[model samples]
Target: MSLARPRALVFDWDNTLVDSWGTIHAALNTMFARMGHEPWTLDETQLKVRKSLRDAFPAMFGDRWEEARDLYLQAFEALHIERLSPLPDAEVLVQAIVARGHYLALVSNKTGRLLRDEVAALGWGHYFAKVIGAGDAVRDKPDRAPVDLALDGSGIAAGPAVWFVGDTGIDMACALNAGCVPILVHGPEGGLLRDEEFADATPARHFRDCMALAREISQ
Candidate 1:
């Protein structure tokens, strides 16, 4: 599939831009332990931790979901910044895109405060016009609310001119729901999860890594 040059870009912050699974896994395990549940293995964390805590916790913890959420948040907040790590060439890619004058925003399922904290910790806050995260919008990703909130003040509408680059099926689905061009930048392993999971929301372009995507966009 061919990619249209973008006027603005909306990015996914977790695995798409940064490698945050370590912190996420640890935090999830801490919550599970507190609740007397079996902790997920790292692989299970990777496979199951896609949706926002608000969206995913209820299913995992039933009536005690809110408590689980608080526990997970506390655990995550305590260590997230220390555990933050950029994927290969992700920082350079974002800097290069900003240098080229493309308007940028981040739309992540990560909690708003934590997401912004990580962004600030990395000193990359200036690169984004908006950093929309969970609870920042009326609804989170896979819904159009976060996408709309992200582009709210940019004077840019959501459509093909807006490229949504992310690594998960949820991100692809969000792009489609928002009428933006969906571009998948899978992590280094490049499976991008199961194909059937997002079969209805196929991406317009797919890149194995951020560096490859950066090269194409810079051209």
Candidate 2:
């Protein structure tokens, strides 16, 4: 299926643009240890860690979820900037998209403060017109609220002319919910098994990585 050229693009932060699994895995384990739960293996972390803390913590940590949230945030804040790095060619992709004159924004499940900090740390604050993160919207990814917030003031309504790009099913679902085109960008980790991993949210197209997506977009 041919994708309509998007006038506006919304990106997910973590695995989509930056390689943050190491920091995220460590922080999650730190929280789990303090909460008296077993630590997840890196593989388990990759497989299961989705959803914002505000959305997922209560289910995992029960009445102590807020405490666990604090622990996780503390660990994440301490480690994130030091460990933060963009995925290969992700900057190239962003630049290419900007050169195409497409409106750009970010919608992430990461805490708003931390997400903004990472963008500034990477000197990428200028790329996105709006950077909506968890708690910035009434609901997180897979919900249309953040997407709507991200596009606010951009003069672009959510529709097929908007491309929501990310590395996870959550992002695809968010795009679908917002009536936008869902474009999946596989990071260095490679593509997901669509039938198994993306059963709930299918992408309109998948690229091997940011470079590949950039190449396609440039065409």
Candidate 3:
């Protein structure tokens, strides 16, 4: 199916525009060690890390979730900025999309302060109309709350015309919940097969990378 040109574009941060798995995995392991939990391998981290800390930590750490949260955040803040890197053609894609006059926003499961910090660090803050991260709204992604917050003052409502681009099933679920068009961007290593990992909330479109998605939008 052909994609409708988006009236607005909403992007996910980690693994969508920026490559953050290494930072995420390292931080998670750091937290695991301090909490006396088993450290996850990179592949395990990729598969298991999805929901926000508030949403996922309780399940993992029970009553000690807050402690785990603090530990994880400290480790992440220490390493994320130093190791942060953008995916190939990510900035080019953002520039091209903005140049086409489409309203843009960001909705990420990453913590709000950390997400904004990463954006500012990359000098890409100006590219988005609103950057809604975890805890920015009453609820996180897949609930449609953050999606609403992201588009709040943009004069754009969440619908088919708003393309929610990301790299995970959570993203596709968010798009589906918010009535936006789900657009998946897979990495060069080929992560998240649409028919397999995302069968329940499949993307409306898929691209191999940022460059491919950029080309599709340009067409």
Candidate 4:
């Protein structure tokens, strides 16, 4: 794909840099069962988990959303680190970018403390200048507030010089909303936003995985 080096890169954590779907799916099901709600299949989890818990839980759990949120956090906190899985070549890409001296930040829908813990667990915390997550900003992804927080003090304005990379439509929408270049990081094995779906977002590029993206940007 045609490209230029970005001044800064902001990434979506789950499924973009790491494979957390299994852990996330299991944790969600655990919460659901405890709440006497039907558990979501893994496929359902992938389809539905695109927003921060604050943004999505109210609609999913109604008046009891706070209780469900607490339960989900308890379950997820217990299992996330043990179940955390890095996507292939993700670490290499992170290293490559750092080596080239590009600023890096993470903007995730995951709870703030939980997201930082996962990054530290992988020993990749040093690579990012900031790690903005749910509740870390006034608003979250697809709203531009988190993106603003992520790039703050990095000296890079949010525009073409910045790239927001992720695997989902929500991520793309966030990038577009923030006026950053949207780059889709697609995993060959998953069912996710297709090319047609991304057309509306006007993504700057699409790579099959981290390796493909690293090669292009690291050049």
Candidate 5:
């Protein structure tokens, strides 16, 4: 597969750009405990909870999805920023791309306001043209709805030229459903859970971190 030089590049937040797993794990553990469910380990939570909240909340919370949503948000709001940090090389990559003038957006399962706040906090808000998150559409990643909302009226037509980069299988599925190219961003040692790996994710190129991804694209 030929990796298109993008007219606009979109990214997934969380593991792809930042290391907020501690915050997430803590909040989720608390949320789950409050509901009398066994708290999931960080790995387990990442594996089972990558779907957009809209898609996963009902199944996880049943009739209490709304209540659970509030609980999760409250938990997250309490600690996410305190534990937030950019991935080792994300900024250099984002900056290099901005320098090249390609439009950039973020498609993440995170809440919209929180995601925006995180971006601004990192001083990286200036790089993204738009950031589409969990509530940005009726549905989320792997559903095509959020992707549609992301592209709608942006004047950027859909298809392969649009690359969706994230650290997991959910991101790959999102790209596939959206009919865009799927790019996996993994550590150089690359260990991710099963079932999220795509049969066709050739990766066009692999990078150790965002800086590496950007350096390659720059070359």
Candidate 6:
């Protein structure tokens, strides 16, 4: 990692900042059943599908994508609001990073509106200067377009001064694609991205959870 301090921190939602896996796993199974795919274990789901549904489902479902999208959204909508909760130390981490005068924003492939609502529901709207979600850019993370959008309105550009912190491979890919440093927060669940399949993904830093991340960044 660079000895240079970051001017800004970008976070990924879903399993990164919050714990929504219960709802997500359940909803994904329902959608998968509708799509004729078998239900995924939480681990498999985390590993296999990380993109915001609208952004990725089209490729997975093709001509039937929109229908699958609706089913997934319907399932997610029915449960996400009620199941959402901040991960351990998430609020503290965000506060600590911001208090240190670092600019902060969120970049997630989750649909833009849903991402906004989730942040608001968590009462975390204040910590972020911006939130970039799927459809907010022409292409989502792992594609660099959304990363560009996240850095778009910032006074700073994407580079060493920025770090994209999250739990999974997609988040790592976003940072890699954008040339931003990637920091992995192992998240509430045991991390799944450390697999050998991700050999090309070498995160600049790895913390067991957000609390560890907060401690490291605050120093």
lDDT of 3: 0.92
Model 3 earns a TM-score of 0.96
RMSD of 5: 2.3
Q: What are the per-residue Cα lDDT tens digits for candidate 3 across 1-219?
A: 887789999999999999999999999999999999999999999998889999999999999999999999999999999999999999999998998999999999999999999999999999999999999999997789999999998889999899999998899999999999999898324444535668788788889989999988777
Location of the lowest summed lDDT over 10 successive residues in candidate 6: 187-196
lDDT of 5 by residue, 95-140 (tens): 8878888777898999989999899888888888788888888878
Of the candidates numbered 2 and 4, which has the greater lDDT value? 2
- Candidate 2, residues 1-219: lDDT per residue as tens digits? 688899999999999999999999999999888888999999999888889999999998889989999999999999999999999999999999999999999999999999999999999999999999999999998899999999999899999999999988888999999999999998324445534668778789989889999998899
Off by over 4 Å in 3: 187-195
lDDT of 5: 0.78
Off by over 4 Å in 6: 187-194
TM-score of each: 0.95, 0.96, 0.96, 0.94, 0.90, 0.91
Could you tell which candidate, 1 or 5, scores higher by lDDT? 1
Better of 1 and 2 by lDDT: 2
lDDT tens readout by residue for model 1, 78-195? 9998888999999878987997888999999999999999999999999999999899999998999999888887889999899999987889999999999998898325344456
- Whichever of 2 and 5 has more lDDT, that candidate is 2
Clashes of 5: 0
Runs off by more than 4 Å, candidate 1? 187-194
Angstrom error of the Cα, residue 4, model 2: value is 1.0
| Candidate 2 vs 5: which has more TM-score | 2
lDDT of 4 at 72: 96
The lDDT for every candidate, in the order shown, is 0.89, 0.92, 0.92, 0.89, 0.78, 0.83
Which ten contiguous residues of candidate 1 have the minimum total lDDT? Answer: 187-196
lDDT, model 2: 0.92
Question: How does model 4 score by TM-score?
Answer: 0.94
The TM-score obtained by model 5 is 0.90
